[model samples]
Target: MSAESRPAIDGRIAELDDGQRRLLFDRRVGDAGEVADATRALLALVRSEGDDALFDFARRFDGVELDALEVPREKWGEALESLDSEVIDALTRAARNIETFHRAQLPSDVEVEVEPGVTLGRVFVPLEAVGVYAPGGRAAYPSSVLMGVVPARAAGVKEIVVCSPPGPDGMPSPVVLAAAAIGGATRLFAVGGAGAIGALAFGTGSIPRCAAVVGPGNRWVLEAKQQVAGEVIIDSPAGPSEVLVVAEEGCAQPAWLAAELIAQAEHDPDAAVAFVTTSPSLLEAVRRELRIGVAATPRREVVAEALSTRGALLLAADHDEMMTFAEAYAGEHVVLCTRDPRADRAGMRTPGTVFLGGASSVAFGDYMTGANHVLPTAGTARSFSGLSALDFLRSYTWQELTAEGAAGMAGPVATLAEAEGLPGHATAARLRGSKAGEETS
Candidate 1:
């Protein structure tokens, strides 16, 4: 295949020019100034107008007129009954796995005595309510319903509210509703986009406000999350989906590798995919296979657009270079198709999730691997993490000091407070010291 005709850029990572480097590392989600302004306006409208704003947005963005935002409680059961038995069974099994996995992630309360007469401890408290946004734009993500709600349920959250876009029938996909039922969602709403996010954050008359919103969506959803970050907690600023695969010369099959790239690319036109290898022959082979795979996929237009714009085939100088590049990129999903994946994975510390070996496709992780797929995108994996049960739990520390301990800490506290020009704090600390002394005397 000619280089010009290939979907992705082929180059050595060390030799990448300015444009190639920017394409690989500067792939941040493009939330333009206009988009941000629009998101702020939408959120403010929802905050002030409540359900009326949501109804208007539904007509304008979703092209649907809605009498109600919340789906009837009985509709969840009805949706489950309407689904195929196989789908119901699959959702049930996935929910079980997800619950089991998140249950294990539930943290134990911790108490410690670090010094004499000073006891410090922390307790995990589940949020009273949480909103889980399942995207219904390009596809209905029943799996996302399980990924978001099951973990919150396992974390002991009382109100697991699900929000998904309504289809032309003026309801979320039946499969999504079925999954919500299986995942034990307390409430479900047929609202979507920035409007849904706003309603969840600020509370409409019909939709209850959530303490935290957890899930993934398009740029508009991400922008809305940013605008309301101070009003409520968000999982992270999600961007387009991304994946990176690192393969050893003989460890990965070209066909399998191509399939993995296509899987991620098909997500959106901006979703990024990359293949890094030290072997020139393997890179060429995978490039050819990618061409073949993209040609036959149903979402070929999206896949091709993503690949042509953001995809890359990187030739690393050696194992060390390959590992370094993968860690630096901090892909949302990293697949180690190496001779010794276990050994190679030890060097990786930043990827949102890692799949060991060629057989461990990212698709499994996306669906039923019992791992949450709402991960940090772009390079945010460098600091953020995949959604987990902990996202639904908040921790606060408490400290108790005996009089002696208080007296001991008072001098230093007063010194620091006075140095920082907080006379009130210093006076309070000195009073504590004096009171302790008086009691001891």
Candidate 2:
């Protein structure tokens, strides 16, 4: 939680038994009070100063000058058309896969007659428009774009808008534009951080307001979402990314497991990548794999910072202990690299997502595994979920009643309204009752 702790570092790997390591992650997974002041200051700027504040933060954090926060529509076509055919093809394939999965999640209208003559129905309607934030922190994020926007499209939202921070050169990345286009984003923007969230929340000159915002960023983004959530709906106040790997006796290769852990840690300095196991030999093997694999990463400093801060090699007494630890951690992404993730999912209840088996790695779920990757992070998996098509739609209930049905229910309706001490409501109910009684008489 110290200011000294937030900066980047490749964490030192030590040979700690599972008990000691599990204890370390348990403490690190919760809120770090030290960052509260920093997050609060950033949010205040977004609320009062608006666009001006965003530009300043853009300049300060991302080192990019911003003439405009909104990316023109024409650029979307240009990016989609200009990208290499091969890369586009890959994204197209992934899009179809992701879309197919999400489309299946769409809920249809339901009609039911709960009473003898009363008919009640439910309808699912897409939101008017939505904004999705894809963080380009320390790297490009085409995958984030696909993950954020595609599901909104699948839910049939009309206007899907996206925002990501500009580069040091003051321009959005071509890959982000291209991916969003494939996922059916109607517009794109250069906005990033809390100011971007504010624009989406309150509307600005260029960035039109959105009904809801979905994506993951630093604590600033998370805090911004919380501050403006009352004005507009937000998917969840996403925090740092995390992954908890539950390793069984027949878990995958230790090196491969380490790669999965490393993939999660690179998202942010607060990223938590951990493994809970019952075998000391497996724990040692995972360490060796982490050492060798981490050496090859360009983002080794970022991964190391995460590991030292939150990464753990928990040694559990048994499977029950592993489950207990995993549920308590409530990881954003739970990877069961064991022989059977399906069986494991039945017992684990806290992850935003469960990736079963080695073949279904967290990266697969992050990209083309057909499951959404924009999941709740920090320890919020206890009460959060990943982004989905359902997040972009609102459902409403409709009811109708025949004259006879209305007459039959008017007395009860009036009684209840009067009992609740609402004369206006009671009068309305009685007026209907009188009319229906007259027709019957």
lDDT of each: 0.89, 0.77
- Model 1 vs. true fold: TM: 0.94
**Compared with the true structure, what per-residue lDDT tens digits does model 2 show for residues 40-156?**
676666667777887787888778888877777787788888899988988888788888999998988999988876899999999998999888767777887888788898898
Q: What is the TM-score of each candidate against the true structure?
A: 0.94, 0.89
Candidate 1 whole-model C-alpha lDDT, 0 to 1: 0.89
Off by over 4 Å in 2: 1-50, 435-441
Pairs that clash in candidate 2: 9-305, 10-304, 11-304, 18-315
Q: Write down the lDDT that model 2 would get.
A: 0.77
